[model samples]
Target: MKQNLWINGESVETENYRPLLNPYTGGQIAEVAEAAKEDVIRAIDSAAEAARGMAEMDAHKRADILRKVADYIQEDREECARLIAEESSKPLKAARAEVDRTVMTYTFASEEARRIQGDTIPMDAAPGGEGRIAYTVKEPLGVIAAITPFNFPMNLVAHKVGPAIAAGNTVVLKPASQTPLSAYKIASYFHRAGLPAGALNVVTGSGKNVGDALIADDRVKKVTFTGSPAVGKYIRENAGLKRVTLELGSNSALIVDEGTDLSKVMPRIVTGAFSNQGQVCISIQRIYVYETIAEDFVSQFVEEAGRLKVGDPLDEETDVAAMISAEDVERAQSWISDAVGNGAELVLGGESEQQVLKPTVLLNAKPTDKISCEEIFAPVVHINTFMDFDEAITEVNESQFGLQAGVYTNDLQKAFRAASNLHVGGVMINDIPTFRVDHMPYGGVKQSGTGREGIKYAVEEMTELKLVSFKLD
Candidate 1:
C-alpha cells in the first residue's frame, strides 16, 4: 500500500516511498511516502491558510464535526483497528482498545469545545474602577503542528488531533515515520466526516526535515510533540511564541513500600513493565523496594516476568510484542549489559530475539547505573532496595525527569507523603508507574515534558485568553 501524505483533506503522492515492516514477523506492512522539503513547505502553507478557516469556524461546528468523526470511527471500527495493528506492531487487544479510544478522545474534546467558556473578571471587586466591566474570551492559536510518537500510534494521534480540531484550530500532524499510516488513516477519517479541507493535514517523513520545517514556520502557531527530551528541547529553542505541549520520555519510578502484598502486586508490575514491550513514557524503569521485603518481591517479580507470553502483537494471547526496531532491542540489551557490568544483578530475562527484548529485572542496582538514571525505553527494569521511606523518596526524586511515580502502599501517611515528596507529575497509589487513562491532565514537571495533554487541558493550551474591559454606559 502506498501511504502518501495527507494535506488539505487530500493525498500528496511522493516520488519516493520506503517499506515499513511488522517488527514481530519481519514482514512488509506498507510503504510510506517520504515527503521532500518542498512538500513540507507546501503542506505548511496549506495548513497555515487552513488555520484561518478553522479559526473562523464556530466551536460548536467544530465539535459537531468531531462528534461525527467519532461516530464514523465506530462504524468502521474493524478496518481502523486492523490498520493500526498492521502498520504499528501494536497487539490485537491493545489495537482494539486504541481504536475504541478514538471515540473517547473526540467525544471528550467535543464536550470541551462546547464548554469553552471564559471566566468573568470581577472588575468592580478589583481595585480598578467600579464602572468597569471585564471578562475574557478564548480564541484559537492559529495553526497547530502535532508530532506524535509510534508507541501507541492511534491513541496518541487522537490525543493531538482531537483537541486541535475541537478547539477550532487547523492542524498538520506529523506522525512518527515508522508508524505514519495509522495517523494517515485517522486523517482520512476526519476528511470524510466533512472536516473542511486544509483544516487537517498529515505529513510523513524524517523529523529533522519535515518536523523542523513545520515548527520553524512562523505560520504554525502551536506545536504538540510527543517524543524524546532532545527533540523537545530543540522545538522549544526554535518554536518561539507558539504554544508547545511536549509529552516526552520519562525514567519513571515505582516504590513498593513495606507490607504491600507481593503476590497481589506481582502481576501488575509484570504487565506494567512489559506492556507494549515497555515503550510507554511512564513505563516503570526504576523500582525502589523497602529492604525487608525486597528479596521476596524481586524473586517473585522476576519469575512472573519470565512466564509472560511474548510473541507477535497480532497474536491474541501474546503478552509482550516486538519493539519498533532491531536497533532499539540492541540498545536495550547494551544498557542491561552495562548495568550488569556495573554490578547490578540481573534476576530475570536479559536477552533479545529480534526486536523482542524479553522483560528483564535487575536487583540490588546502584544509583549510579545508567539503567536507573536514563530512559531505558525497553522492557528492562531496575530494582533497588531502600532502607527507609525517606531514602526511597530521596532516591526516586533524584532523576532529572519528574514525569510520574507509583507507591504501592496502604498507609495514609506514607501515601500522602509520597504524593507530596515524589517530585513527579502524577502518582499512582497501588499501581505501577504506567497507569494513564487518556483523559486526565497528564504531563511531567521537569525534563519529561511541559504542559498537559487531557482534552480540556489541551483545549486550553490551544487557545489564547484575551481579556476585554469596558466602562458601563
Candidate 2:
C-alpha cells in the first residue's frame, strides 16, 4: 500500500518515503510520503491561501460538507477500522469504536457549524449607551495547524480537524509518522465531501521536520496538538503568539469507594486500564480502593484481567494488542521492574511477548515510583488502599497530571465532594475516567494539557470574537 501526502486537495508524491509498519507484526503495511520542511511550508501556504474561501463560505454549506464527510466515513467504516488496527495496534473492536466516534465527531461538528453564535451585549446598561446596540460575532482564525498522536488516529484527528473546519478555518495537519494512513484517508473523505481545495492538508513525517515548520510559519494562526507533555511544552514555548490548544499526558486514577458494588463496575475498570494497551491519554493507570474492599477488588480485578485475549489486533476476540513499539514495551518493562524493586507487589502480570505487555497489576506501589507517579502509558496499573475518601482524593491530586479522575461512590456527598475538590479537568461520579463522548468539553489542566476539545468548545477556540456595535445617527 502507498499513502502519499494530501496537499492542496490532491495526492502528492515526495522524493523520500518512510515505511509504515504494523505495530503487532512489524511488517511494512504502507510506504508513506515523508514530508520535508519544504513540503510542510507548502502545506502552510496552501492552507493560508484557502482560508479566505473557507471563511467566505456559508455556515450551512460548511455544515453540509461536514455531514457529507460523516456519511463518507460511515460508508467506509470497516476499512477505516482496519487501517486503524493495522497502523496503531488498536484491537479491531476498539478500532471500530474509534471509527464510530470519528463519525459522530464530524456529525457534531456539522451541528455546531450551524449553531455558532455570539451573545448580544446590553449596550443600554452603560451610562452613555442609551441609543446604542452592541453584539459579537465569531470569525474564522484563518489557517490552523493540527499535530496528532498515534493513538486513536482517526478519532483524535476528527476532534481537531472537524472543529477547525466547522469554524471555517483551513488546516495543515501533521499526523504521527506511525499512523499517517488514517489521516490521509480522512483527507480523501473531506475532498470527496466537496471541501474546497487546500482547506485541509495532511503532511506525514518526523515532527521536527513537518511540525516545526508548521509552528514556525507565520501563515498558521492556531496550533492544536495532542501528544506527550515534553513535546507539548516545547510547542507552547516556541509557538510564539499563535493560539495553542494542547491535550497532553495523564496518569488517570479511579477511586473505588467503600460499599461500592464491585461486580457492576469491574468490567469497565478493566477495560479502562487495558484498552489500546493503555496508550490512551485517559487510560486508567492508578486505582485508589477503599481499605475495606481492596482485597476483594484486587482479586476480582486480576481474575477478569486474565480473561482478556491478547493477540493480533485483527482478531475480533482480541481485547489487548501490542503497544506502539518495542521501545515502549521495554520502557514499560523497566518501569514495572523499578516499581517491583521498590516494594511493589506484581499481583497478576509483569511479562511481555514482543510488543504486547500482558495486563499488569501492582499492589502497594510507592507514590514516588515511576509507575505510580508518571504517565506509564502501558497496560500496568498500580493499586493503593485508602481508608478515608479525603486521603484518596489527596493521593489522586498529588501527581502533576490533572486530566480526569473517577469515583465509584453512591453517596451523594462523597460524589459531590470528589466533583468539587479533585484537581482535574473532569470528575466521573460512577464511571471510569476513560469515558468520553465525541461532543463533550474534553481537555485537562496542570501538566495534562490546556484548552478544550469537544466540537463546540474547539470551535470557540478556532474562531475569533468580533464586536459589532451600532449607534443611532
Candidate 3:
C-alpha cells in the first residue's frame, strides 16, 4: 500500500517517501510520504484557513459528522485493526481493542460536542450591582496541533483529534513516524464523513522536522502531545503561551496488600504489565506486594507471565509481540541485564529475539535501579516486598513520575487511604493502572503530563471561555 500526507482534504504525495516497516516481520508494509518542514507549515496554514469554517459549524452538525466518522470506523474496524497491528507491531487482539476504543472515543466526542457548556453567574448574588446578568460561553481555540505516539495509534490519535474537531478546532496531526498508516486511515474516515475540507490534516515525518515546526508555528493554537517526558518538557518550554496538553511517560506502580485474592488480580497484573509489549504509558512497571503474600504473588505472577504466547502480532493467540523496533528490544534487554547485575533476581523471562523481548519479572530491584526508577516502556516489571501499606504507598511515590497507580485490597479504609495518599494522578482500586475508559478525566500530575484528556475534558481544554455581561439601561 502507498500512503501520502492528508492535507486540505487531498492525499498529496511528496518526492520523498519513507518505507513503513512491519516490526514483527521486518518487512516493508507500505511507503508513507515523508513530510518536510514545508509540508508542516502548509498543513498549519490550511488548518488556520479552515479554523473559522469549523467554528461557524453548528454544534449538532459537528456531532453528526463525528458520529458518522465513528460509524465509518466501525464499518471498517477489522481492516483498521489489521493496519494498526501491521504498522505498530501490536497484537491483533490488542489492535482490535484499540479500534473499538477509538470508535468509543469518537462516539464520546460526538456526544460531548453538544454538551460543551459554560456556567451562568448570578451577578446579583455576587455583590455586583442589581439588574446585571452574566453568562459564559465556550469557544473553540482556532487550530490544534495533535502529536500522538505509536502505541495505541488509533485510540491516542482519536483522543486528540476527536476532541479538537468536536470543539470546532481545525487540526494538524503529526502521528508517530513508525505508525502513520492508522492516522492516515482515520483522516480518510473523517473525509468520508463529510467533514469540511482542510479541517484535519495528517503530516507524517520526523519529530524534529514536522513536530517542532507545528509546535513553533503561531497558527497552531493548542498543542496536545503524548510522548516522552524530555520531549514533553521541551514542548512545555517552547510552546510559548499556547494552550498545551501533554500526556507524557510513566513508570506506573501497583500495590498488592494482604488478604487480597490472587486469582482476581493476577490476570489483570499480567495484562497490565505485558499488553502491547508494555509500551503503554500507564503499564504496570513496579509491583509492591505485602510480605504476607509476596512469595505467592511473585510465583503465580511469573507463572502467568511465562505462559504468555510470544510470536507474530497477526496471530490471534499471540499475547506478546515485537517492540516498535529492534533498538527498543535491545534497550529493554539491557535494562533487564542491568537490574540483574545490581542484585535484582530475575525470576522469569529476560531474553530477546530480534524485535521481541520476553516478558520479564524481577525481584528485589533497588529503588535506584533503571527498571524501577525509569519508564521501561517494555514488557519488564519489578516486584518488591513491603510490610506496611503506608510504606508501599511511599515507595510508589518515590519516583518523579506521578501518572497512575493501582492498589489491590478489600479493606475499604486501606483503599481509601491509598487513593488519598498515592502521589499519582489516578488510583485504581482492585484493578490495574492500565485500565482507562474513553470518557474519564485522564491525565497525570507533575512530569507525567499537563491537563486532562477524555472527550469532555479535552474539549474544555481545546476551547476558551468568554463571558457576556449585561446591565440594565
Candidate 4:
C-alpha cells in the first residue's frame, strides 16, 4: 500500500518516500511519504488558518463528528488491528485491544466536548469588584502539534488527536516514522466523518526535520508529545511560551508485599512485564518483593514468564513478538548481558533471535545496574528483595522516573502508606502499574512527563481559560 501525508483533507505526496517495514518478518509492507520541512510548514499554516473555524463550530457538532469517527473505527476495527500488528509487531490480541481503547478514547472525547465547562465567579465577594460579574470560558488554543510514539500507535495518537479536535483546535500530527500508516488511517476516519478541510493534518518524516519544524513554528499554539525524555526536553527548551504536554519514558516498579496471594499476582505481573514486548511507558521493570515471600514469588514469576509463546505477531496465540527493530533487540540483550556481568542472576530467559527477544527475569540486580536504573523498554524485569515495606518504597523511589508504581498487598494501611510515600504520579494498590483505562488522568512526573493525558485532562491542556467580566449598572 502507498500511504501519503494527509494535509488539508487531501492525500499529498512528495517525491521522497520511505519504506514501512514489518518488524516481525523484516519485509516491506508499505511506503509512506516522507514529509519535508516545507510540507510541515504548509500543514501548520493550514491548521492555523482553520483554527478559528473549528473553534467557532458548535460543541454538539464537534461531538457528533468525534462520535462518527469512533463509529468508523469500530466498523474497520479488524483492518486497523491488522495494520497495527503488521507495522509495530505487537501481538494480535494486544493490537485489537489498542483499537478498542482508541475507540473508547474518541468516545470519551466526544462526551468531554460538551462538558468543557468553566466556572462562574461571584465578584461581589472581592473588595475591588462589588458590582461586577466574573466568569471564565474555555477556548481552544488555536493549533496543536501532536507527536506520538510507535507503541500503541493507534491509541496514543487518539489520546492526543481526539482531545485536540474535541476541544476545537486544529491539529498537525507527527506520528512515529515507524508507524505512520495507523496515523494516516485515523486521519481518513476524520475525513470520512466530515471534519472540515484543513482541520487535521498528518505529517510523517524524520523527527529532527518534521518534528522540529512543527515545534519551532509560531503558528502552532500547543505541542503534545509521547517519546523519550531527551526529545521531550528538547521540545520544552525550544517551544518557548507555547503550551506543551509531554508524556515521556519511565522505569516503572511494582512492590510485592508480605501476605499477598502469589497465585493471583503472578499472572498479572507476567502480563504487565511482557505485554507489547514491554514497550509501554508504564511497563513493570522493577519488582521489590518482601524477603519473606521473595523466593516463592520469583519461582512462580519465572514459570509464568517461561510459558509465554514467542513468534510472529499475527499469530493469535503468540504472547510475545518482535521488538520495533533489530536495534531494539540488540539494545535489550546488551542491557541484560551488562546486568548479568555486574553480578545480577538471570533467573529465567535472556535469549534473542533477530528482532525478537525472549522475556527475561533477573535477580539481585543492583540499583545502579542499567536494567534496574534506566527505562529498559524491553521484555525484561529485575527482582530484588526488600526487608521492610519502607525499604521497598524507598527503593521504588530511587529512580529518576516517577511515572507509576504498583503494590500487591491486602493490607489497607500498607497500601495507603505506599500511596502516600511513593514518589510517583499514580499508585495501584492491588493491580500492576500497566493497568490504564482510556479515561483516567494518565501521565508522569519528573523525567517521565509533565502533563496528564486522559481525554478530559488533555482537553484542559489543549485549551486556555478566558476570564470575562461584566460591570452591573
Each candidate: RMSD: 1.4, 0.8, 0.9, 0.8
> What ranges in model 4 sit over 4 Å off?
none
Stretches of candidate 2 exceeding 4 Å from the true structure:
none
Model 1 over residues 346-383: C-alpha lDDT tens digits? Answer: 88888877577888988766777778889988888988
By lDDT rank, best first, the candidates go: 2, 4, 3, 1
Q: By TM-score, how accurate is candidate 4?
A: 0.99
45-126 in candidate 4: lDDT tens per residue?
A: 8898899999999999999999999999999999999999999999999999999999999999999999999999999887
What TM-score would every model get versus the actual structure? 0.97, 0.99, 0.99, 0.99
Worst 10 residues of 4 by lDDT: 347-356
lDDT by residue (1-473, candidate 2, tens digit) is 77888999988888899788899998999888988898898888889889999999999999999999999999999999999999999999999999999999999999999999999999889799888888999999999999999998999999999999999999999888888889998999999989999999999988889988988988888999999999999999999999999999799999999989999899999999999999999999999999989999999999999999999999999999999999999999999999999999999888899689999999999999999889999999999999999989999999999999999998899999899999999999999999999888999999999999999999999999999999976
Against the unseen true structure, what C-alpha lDDT does each candidate score?
Answer: 0.85, 0.93, 0.92, 0.93
Give the per-residue Cα lDDT of candidate 1 at 215: 80
What 10-residue stretch in candidate 1 is worst by lDDT? 82-91
Pairs clashing within candidate 2? none
Residue 152, model 4: Cα distance from true site in angstroms? 0.7
lDDT-superior candidate, 1 or 4: 4
